[model samples]
Target: MHPTTTLLPLPAEAPPSLTQILDEVTTVLCHILPSSLSVKSFSTRWQVLRSKLATLKSSISEVSDSLHWSESPLLQTLLPNILSTLHRVQTLCDQCSDPTFNPGKLLMQSDLDMATGWLSNQIHDLDLLLRSGVLRQTNAIVLSQPVPGSGKEDLGFFIKDLFTRLQIGGIEFKKKAMESLLQLLSDDEKSANLVAKEGNVGYLVQLLDLNSHPSLREQAVSAVSILASASDQSRKFVFEEGGLGPLLRTIESGSTGLKEKAAMAVEAITTDPDNAWAISAYGGVPILIELCRSGSTTAQSRAVGAITNVSKVEDIRTALVEEGAIPVLVQLLNSGTASTQEKAANCISILASSGEFFRALITQQDKGLQRLLQLLHESSSSDTLEHVLRAIYSLSASESISRVLSSSTTFIIRISEIIKQGSIISQHISASLLSNLSISDGNKRAVSGCMGSLVKLMESAKPDGIQEVAANALVSMLAVRSSRKELVRDEKSVMRLIQMLDPKNELVSKKFPVAVVSAVMAGGSQGCRKRLVAAGAYGVLQRLTEMEVAGAKKALQRLSGNRLKSILSRTWRA
Candidate 1:
């Protein structure tokens, strides 16, 4: 029925032997040995080769213990050579990736030919070793004892070995040990905690010193980054153990890779509020600012992160601004990658929080406002949107910035939309910006067009700060004749303002609504006055006139003129 119902057996598919995998990896590596290539193309090829080699290394490590090396003396003899070849390949990869090295000029055609010949010989040796029944070996010599389980004792012993190696091993051995420990700490939080508790931060700090090998120092910084990232205790240990000096030095002068790792570690340490001051004290702020300007993209990003964390403290923020970080940060905002832009924006937001002086400097010197507005229009990231909005809000406190922002129709409309649709933080910041911008007559007129949105914000069940700011914005809008009529004509807005005059409300809440009512009444618009009286404004004003609150007397006077003051005087006389 089915062509004699005979199912021919499928060809037996053989799994790749270890030698085959090694040969495949070596072939990939050999492809990168071509000279006379474009720098960009060479970089691409090099990255591919590096990835393949890393995969091969990981594969070997995963199976090394199970390999029966003694069963085939030939394979056993070649094992160390194979590992040495792999390490040399990795070293070459590292050299290529080094930021300082110009790969295009470093390797001539003759040099590449030599490298190719050497790699060919290594590949042939590996083939010979594999053919001598290397993959068939089963009897293994247990040269190293295995730690049976991942118990506390096992972890302790493992950490002790790492510490011993870090303390006394030669440069290469120290680098490997540190890299292994860093990987272990990153992979296992328990190990990081144990390392931190055991006071190993001092050794890590020592490895970062200037006298150490650059590669070893880089590994030490990475280890510190992992440890600091794991927990607050580790962060404190790193900070207290005098790690900041070496870390900052590395950021200032180490290789590009080292700078990135050191910046990251600094960021981790600065997350604790207490250590932030220490960084500033160590002259780290200016160095971080410099990195943001000249370091690689990754280092710039990490530097921005560290600056953001450190800028959380008021004193440090002032110090950062004085170090001319504002303009540099603005530059990064305009040209850096998306992550860098967000971090720079966030750092500027914190710096802007320090005072109006920094705000003016940021908005005036660097075209910061223009850049922020552009990012706001282009970015879909909520974090970027939030930070940029906050920075704008703070910078708008400057009178000049307020006028400038109000002059831009697109800026004003976008702010209105953000208030309507953004996250809670964004909405609040937008409302505050509106309030700040509305201080100028031009801003008052511009913001007045969005009266309905501001009215809705004032009517919302938001926090006291947001509602207060929204009310203040409406007050500014009502002070403008064109916006006054629209606000008065909106019966819902009139009712919301009347509701805010409650005596039981917080003093801050009552202030803005009273001022808004007073502005509308003082405008002498018959329609607005009618609406206010119709919305039970007289009773609210009458009650406020009885309280000893600030602005109550002025509000009553504006609402009812001299009659309210006379009535109040009569009530006191009674």
Candidate 2:
């Protein structure tokens, strides 16, 4: 049998003598105090001392209550003094553990000397009383057994002992051992690392198995949650030890508290990509979706967070959508907290990225587009807006959705405003959305009203992709007769299009500009043609005609009869 599982024999039913009790108290105090000289050890030393003191106080009370006080006056008198000394020592330990206490300054040699001297006086008085036969001697109370080993070695032994008890001990013993291990894992990252490195993580994982006691399984779930949350390395260790299978099982069938903690553990573990696939294989996606839909607030948040992480991969994202994650995430977006709303938006973004089928699924949900637009309007966070815009961009890929969004004056204005003022990514997405919306004639005219902003975006020194999208939006708008007239009326707009005809520009950069010029010349309005010519369109087109670029040849062919062209031809010949 494991030593930790071996319950020590209980003491006989007799009141202890004063001398024996004092000796027992002294031994407890000795273990509580630090033997090392470093002041850094003070906090740990105080914690151990405080725990031992509680057990000693309980034992002393038990012995005192059993005595016949009137028949033992000396014992009674000395008991009060001894108890008083214990109380003082307990108070001192409490102060040392207080957050505000600076160990570096408070743990001076002089302070230690004073405290030890006082304790010695109390012990000496108790001994003198014993010699005078004023207090009877009884068997010493063995309050508790001291853990074997010291310092770092002690932590290793303590973990091994707990594991042994967990394996072979009774229900009550297992509970106590599990609780002890849980407390150590909860203390800090260092403690959790110690537990993981000691090969106890696998044992803890075993406790979570189906065959383990329900209560032990619950405690084990809670411990795994702590270890997984304490550090990334510890979380990886739990996953490697096969934590995901039991954790998902608990989420599916455990009690409410266990389910909540198990969900949290699964969430932490799923941060690793391999574990995410394992969770999905264990059929965790459907369970997570249910948790998001109906679990407690904490469970719902963690469930959604896990789904968000899991949905990052393509195959899993398709599975999540098929399980109807889109509508549930849309519901969460409308009613959940800001954080939940953000995560839901991210999941939706990923799902929507899968393809047009998933995009249509999200768009077809009741108030799905409305909720996403509302979130876009209400959110001040850049990340949330970025995801919302990405989803919008995907949804806009469907011409039906694009036409719906394009027809809404409010939606068009909001997207145009984002292009004008949002973050760089937001600007890029908004531009892409506008480009998609511009595919429809009515949407073209609607976006054409914001021509100045589009022009500025194209002119800014952002990446070619952003500028290309903006240019495409402008070119699409130019296809509408009214928008074409608007472009020709603004000389700077006309001049910008003319400048884009520069031969050195990339083929992509030149495509829209060529299309815009061709559209204007095709309008055949003499006044618009004269405005383009005045905006230096003649020189740009003459050069393009020489190079025989696609749309430039067609545009130059149409300008053949201009009397103004003759004057420009003489200047070009020079």
Candidate 3:
């Protein structure tokens, strides 16, 4: 009996090794090339198919050496399908090589086209496997084994493993991987550094593709948002990978939650000016404007923040203004939550600072000034108040806005209260604004009511700049005779102006104080000039005159002439 030739089936529990599968694939390709070459009519089609198979084979060989082929989840998932495709090619090749096989030409052509497409897909799969950083598994393995006495577990392995899933896993797997990755990034900035170091930020950017599932894109954007917000290095990498274009698309088309995360990412990445301009070039301003106009509060806040950052670029600020962002921002100032209102206020301030055109736009917006003033009354956060004050201050720089502001007596009184009671920074801005407003001849009387507040601010403000601003504002107000008379009537206010002229009193500008005193002397009664001279104005003006401070020489001459006249009058009376 021929040694009993009963063939035993291989164990179902054990799959073929990677090396065995690769060998089988190579053998099948070798058979396909010779067999395909023999079919004369379809030789060109066969050549194309064979070339694709050969490329797939080469990709597999290249990655197999660097990757631990046995342990690779990529190969484990892809190899079975890859091997099944090779078998189909092998059967197709055999049919083409068979002399007796007579499948119609159309059938043969279809078979060849199908085989070529299959090989192309397999090649792409292999490409993804190699790009997935499967070779980095060596680092993961070494990192997985704990070092002696190192209490902290290294997450190198976990991060790399997640990247592999993002790069090569199916949609469900990628979604899960992104969720875990975001959680990891949210929990520790170290993971973001690792992800950046691993050069896998592009993987997250890839998931932002418009063709990606909405849930996956949202998760991916969330991950990117965390990474960008956490590290500048990762943010640079994200921008390099063209993250802004996709992020803008997400803002325009994605769901509210996705748009919010994308806007946050855009805001964080755009901290760099290059990224800011890049966003504008990609037409991000209008999308962000629309989001601020219609998105949820969180989305509106983030979009406004992004606009704020982008508008730091001069041209981009022009673009934002042209896109009608000012009115939308003004609308938010009235309707958004406090945080949103603050963001809107800040963006408007930035726009206002950019140019006179933006300031005019802000002023021209419906109820823009009204909404900002309302915020000052309603917002309890110092940050919000600061931003609103800054926006108003910026608007106040425009002559038209200044005239409008000066016309409102209620506005003038409220500003006086703010100068007295607001934060020091708010006080400083308010004082500066008051100075600007006082320049308008028509505004002088309306703003003159704030003179007491300005005098108190000059004496009590901490920063020298604030005091200087108040003194300067007092000088502007003094341009009106009514303001000078009020100052002379309040002897203490005249005394404060005298104190400011002292060279030793360095907190206020000498020119401003000199101007204030000159106006007060010129407008006051002779008794008022006598009181000023008694209050030490003569010595302060004399020193300032020697120091060559502007307006000082004339001021001292004025005071001396007044004193000489007063002495002559006394003699004449005696």
Candidate 4:
């Protein structure tokens, strides 16, 4: 015998490599292997081997950098999907490979946490797209619902198999598969296009009609955002699909979580002027007004954003103002919380910029001015104050309205005190409010008594402070033609202004430098211009000319031309 061990025959099923371990079996298997198997058996085994080889090759191809088909559209489209599929597949494989990733436990626990995090983010982005979703075909609300008997579905069986493999394979394998799926959906354009082609958008809309789950609502909203935002066509679909109605209802539905998103839908709807009209046609105005009136603070904020979007149109703005948004906002500025105060103040400020708003709102100056002053004095929040000052600036900017409030010495003194005590931002705003006060002759006299302090305030306050006060004061002072003007007789007054115009020794503390420079240029006559020029005004003017591109350049150009030569001629020769 070739070996001491005896065997009847080597089994056909034994692996070839195992034969070497058996001294006698190796020779016996070699001799018997060819005759033991029939042709049919050999063919069947070969087919199985071929199939296994193909699967191995497919898996290997997924990991290869060469498979990164950046050139072909088909590859580009399929690559992300293929990769995501493989990622999800591998993650599942790895989970089953380890016992720690048990389905019986919480899904968020252990390695499942990673997958849930990924899925949650995906769900979040998808939710953003839903309410905003504009399908290439048509727009519809989307809701997702889980179907029954999914347990017995073929996909479920494959999934079960994959999980089993994951338990044996490890978490790393499962993670790899999940990564591939995420990569595909991450690119918005590609994903949206694919979604359009597959009628996923339509299906989602159908889901929206039937489903009420918070998770489904969130996902649906995401898709809508993507579509409405993506194109005009998509937005049109969203409006046609009755999206706004549901969103408005959601705003009032008392779901704090959904309120913000509902408002976002309104914002997207009003992004285009035509859409604004469509929204108005759809009765968005009263809904938004009510949202502003009675919705939660968050809801109100969102409602305001929605209003702002539509307010770009003149009709929408007029509707809002007519609905008493202006007075309500003015009222809220005083009575609302800090956040509400700020929001109301900002909206009024925006409204005040419109000629219509000013005509409608500021016409009642004394009544409004009193409320604004109260806000200025009472609120401690810096944000509220800044915006309150801006709103005042916008409203009282008109000479007529300002004349009404200018009669109040109390208002004048309070404003003056604020200029002195407030921070730089406050100083800038205080200075602006002063511009409005100067519009009235009576108020000018009251402020002129503090002209000494005004001069000092000008010296220390910031450039923003200087801009409005100096510019407006110069115009108003020159416009007065008053020999009896309260400020004109103060000899040190002109002198103080001249010192501020000096450029060489820049007192960076000047609150409104740009405005101050402008005021000097505007009000200073040939002689006064000469004085400011001599006090090193040119250097600062030139520096500002170079530094700023807007109104600052216009001021510099005016000073450099006729004003400079004329002033020198008047001051030097005389």
Off by over 4 Å in 1: 1-158, 165-180, 210-217, 277-286, 309-324, 349-369, 381-403, 423-425, 438-446, 452-467, 488-495, 502-508, 523-574
Clashing pairs in 3: none
| TM-score of model number 1 | 0.60
User: How big is the positional error of residue 96 in model 1, measured in Å on the Cα after superposition?
Assistant: 55
Task: Report lDDT per candidate.
Answer: 0.71, 0.71, 0.77, 0.52
TM-score, cand. 2 vs. native: 0.57
* lDDT of model number 3: 0.77
Off by over 4 Å in 2: 1-195, 209-219, 229-232, 255-257, 312-322, 439-464, 478-574
Across residues 495-563, which tens digit of lDDT does each residue of candidate 1 receive? 777877877655335666777778777776667766787888888877887876668787776766645
Instruction: Highest TM-score: give the candidate number.
Output: 3
Error of 2 at 21 (Å): 23
Candidate 2, 49-117: lDDT as tens digits? 444444444544444454332243334455556555665665555555466766565554345445555
TM-score of each: 0.60, 0.57, 0.78, 0.44
Error of 1 at 347 (Å): 3.6
By summed lDDT, which 10 consecutive residues of candidate 1 come out lowest?
137-146
Residue-pair clashes per candidate, as listed? 0, 1, 0, 65
